[model samples]
Target: MRPPSRSSLILFAAVLLAGCASTSSTQTTPGSVPMTQDSTPLVGTDWRLVSAPGTRAGATLSGAGAATLRFEADRFSMRGPCNRHTGAWSRSGDQLRFGGEGGAVAGTKMLCPPEIMARETALLAAMQQPLTMEFEGPFLRLVAGDGSAWRFDSRDLPPAEGRERIVQVAGQRVPCTGAAPMLCLQIRTQPGAAWQAHYGEIEGFDWQVGVEYVIRVREYTVQDPPADGSSLRWVLEEVLERSP
Candidate 1:
């Protein structure tokens, strides 16, 4: 081991660095590296927009009905504060990809209040990128590539049993456009009372156009309704009266 030349010293330093790198790699902690796995059951889960780690603050979360994100089989839908958006979705390990390849999200263009539109714009942008999903109980968090996130809360379980009620249904369908273009049946609690357009559907009930009916029905809030559907469903219990 005579005095080492400059060339030898440089070579020795390089070998030392290479050995240290090998050792460091072998000694790395499992938690220090990201782990990927199949995410929780996202299908049929409807997440209501709420405050999250790095999402917009205050009014955005509190305004309107906020927004909702629901996942399906290879697809996802979002109801923004203003518009309705939908896109193709697929998950790999812990990541969620929106659209298809490089496609953009599609949505309705209905204009809304300025504050609502602002929130909708941000929500739509967030959904168009790569996201890492995490869940904690009833909450879901979607972290974007830039570290920002959108958090949604949910309790999609079905509700308790319903109560039976007696009601009258008109013989004809009236046009109702509350949520979208559709026809609604006129219903009332009393025969002499005013008729209110029933925006929600009545299950298990069939009506002939010229026949009026009085029926006993079971009404309850749906436990796991569709993302854009009404939570209430009325099922016909008994036919008390039917007159043509």
Candidate 2:
């Protein structure tokens, strides 16, 4: 058998750990959550994430904040949510069992703002209940009975218009540097290749980087940007580049 993906492990751990701290004051209403009709076990079908009410602590959500869940006979894979997570699963009556503590999930270590992290923490804590799943049209509704819900479907993104070369910025690259810990890289947008950006916590502060590459130095400044005020300034202590 093949090994499980890292994201899957993390998702499993996060979900499990989220359940560890159960003293949060939030009380769940006592009632039976409606389950989807027993057409077939959703464990072998592909489902896409439509909406995630709660967020995570240290990560960036991709696109409109949606993800995909591909459920195998004994395992599953979740794509989107800015990361891919998968692992084994089991079902007992109405209770679903995602791979317990043994599974692993690889995720971005980058931290999010404190407030956002709190929300994510709450969501994780909310995942402790006997979750419920129902079919909402083409989407699957995943509810943890703690007021948190997620939607999924099966749809692939459209392909790019044409083939293009990936250009490297010669002098436009900014080395992210400062006391704050972040894998920051500032690169000026080039022709054809518009800057794609994603930035969350900076100097332990909340900063938004739209398109990941298109640098908006002004926005960083209003929120108390680097004291030096260098638009082209960035620091990436850890960076992984894929070869073409």
Candidate 3:
């Protein structure tokens, strides 16, 4: 047997440490670690956000500015771009009922970029819709139908036109702008109508840039219908921004 020496003892300790580190690294690798694929769908499983729309927002999970949703069975907790919110939800097929019990989570007062803030508000409002969930691995994507088949970005929004359509509010031929995405009607109170409602949006698909935009409006009937043929006008609203 080799006689014990201070140098030898130090060498033995180093070798043992090296072995332990190698084993730990190997176990952490994707394949070497034993992983049992969960056959069950993710609806009932508690899932935290693993990826996000942009890094400008910072890492997902564990931050107020971070957008996260921890979903487990029928309950969920969310952290919006500005506030922390959580609520209970129920799912049937693609339809989702998102409000049962939840409140804002208290956290630090950190402000995000304007665009990020806008997107976060829109996303939170959208959660109110009955949702359809698509499961891919550990991710659950929820989608809502706001009657928009396409999406657009802020840059994509066309310049507002000066031309206007002559429509009677109280009863007047007011100048107005009418376009596919934008609709504006100027009212002249003197002529009985003097208010203009301008609405516009653009839509397209550019995944590399991450843009989803839509604008819509819903119309209803008053006790008296306008001279115009239509009694109701519906509009949807959405805006997408390029990831910077």
Count of clashing residue pairs in every prediction: 1, 28, 28
Candidate 1 lDDT over 1-244, as tens digits, reads 1122210111112111010001122222211222333244577767888764433344234323357788766557877665666656655555666666323456666534333455566656665565787877677788877887777788643443687676778888899886578988988875466778888778778878877766667788788987657678897654545654
State residue 231's C-alpha deviation in candidate 3, in Å.
68
lDDT of 1 at 63: 29
Ranking by lDDT: 1, 2, 3
TM-score of each: 0.44, 0.41, 0.34
Q: Where is model 2 more than 4 Å wrong at Cα? A: 1-41, 54-65, 101-128, 157-244
Q: Model 3, 1-244: lDDT tens per residue? A: 1122210101112111010011111112111211234233444333444333433332222232335555564456555554555555554434445553332222333334344465565665566555555554444556567631111111112343232121212111234444333333322212222355533211221222222111112233434645543444432221112222
Q: Highest lDDT: give the candidate number.
A: 1
Least lDDT summed over 10 consecutive residues: which range in candidate 1? 14-23
RMSD of 1: 24.4
lDDT of 2 by residue, 180-223 (tens): 53454333234334433323332322224332221112122244
Comparing 2 and 3 on TM-score, the stronger one: 2
lDDT of 2: 0.39
CA lDDT of each candidate?
A: 0.60, 0.39, 0.35
